[model samples]
Target: MRGLRKYLTPFAPDQSGAVSVLYELGGIIVICDAGGCTGNVCGFDEPRWFERKSAVFSAGLRDMDAILGRDDRLVAKLVDAADKIDANFAAIVGTPVPAVIGTDYQALKRMCEKKTDLPILAIDTDGMELYDKGEEKSVSCIIYCICKGKI
Candidate 1:
């Protein structure tokens, strides 16, 4: 008999949902995970992936990166990408790697702010939850960021 799988597909997780809402918002959306999560979101989770263009990217987290909790590298990559591209805003979507490693998103946001003047937002999706939860958190964060003049 086929063994049971711990992870299921057929739907995007919270991280993907967070990215989806910000897809058309003229922002550089970064998914903080390995490439597989990005592929799933782009290939399956996101319906407009083929119809439109977005600046969604994967952080390309490696074993060392996750184990050491290297937020600096992630910040550097985001900064470089942001400098190379023109975006009205920037969003950092979290995933299992970051969640498992306890990455500091608030600090990352501050670091990104120091490097770039563009408005920045972060969705703290841990990948263990569903899509709607991510969407809700992201949307609320966007509003909060705007209200606090962080965006």
Candidate 2:
């Protein structure tokens, strides 16, 4: 059967929603993708993106980095960005690339902590799911981090 949704595209994924959850918080939001996911979140998914300012960024994950599990490189980039910006915390929102590679978010958070004093907020999201799933995970993680005194 021919698809009738030529004018439409895939709905906003969980990754973008995860970023949106932290939009108001004064923290560095890092979208763990090659690049486009951040654009989508800021340009399309996030309605308040234009009206407000946040420290959202992309990890710029390359194919080799994902395949080889070069998490130290990611930690370096996060530390560099954090150094340049004033943030109270840091949130790592995962995408399909990291999910496929089984990125260890807990380890990443620990490495980031060693590099910087900012608390780490992890949103475990894979691009395959819907927006609500990511938002839910993000909220849950934030609550968990807060209760555990990690954030």
Candidate 3:
């Protein structure tokens, strides 16, 4: 994905860019939303979805989950997915739901770090930003992974 960007959608937001970089990283990229963001990434944004598979998932946050700020439930879900899937690392891709609820990515990262063996990445990208911004944070995550020898 370095020096190459291909997005079929007309307006690819940060969520799209995050999934783009994460798609090639071989780790689980969990979209921290109910469903819309994950749908956009798998349905159209990242063209690679149709060609290959990646560990992309939705938190399946219900209305009360977001309203009640249920970070524990999210951590449990992430840990469960980690235990079930074979992945190099795990990334929590932010979306409108967590962004609106003011989810503390650091806390979530720490929480996941305790229960899981894989490295955790927290990309706090709101749906409001552009694709480049998402790529920026995701690329930084790549660097982090590389530095930690997880890549």
Better of 1 and 2 by TM-score: 1
Better of 1 and 3 by TM-score: 1
Give the whole-model CA lDDT for all candidates, comma-separated.
Answer: 0.87, 0.88, 0.88
Q: Compose the digit string of candidate 1's lDDT tens values, residues 22-116.
A: 99988999998888889989998898999998999999999998898788898899999988999998888888888878988888888898999
CA displacement after TM-score superposition, residue 116 of candidate 2 (Å) = 0.9
Poorest 10 consecutive residues by lDDT, candidate 3: 5-14
Q: Give one digit per residue, the lDDT tens place, for model 2 in 57-139.
A: 99999999899999998899999998999888999999888997899988998899899999998788888888888889989
Off by over 4 Å in 1: 1-10
Ranking by TM-score: 1, 2, 3
Candidate 1 CA-lDDT value: 0.87
Candidate 3 per-residue C-alpha lDDT over 1-54 given as tens digits, one digit per residue, 9 for 90 to 100: 789976443378898888898898788888999998899989988888899999
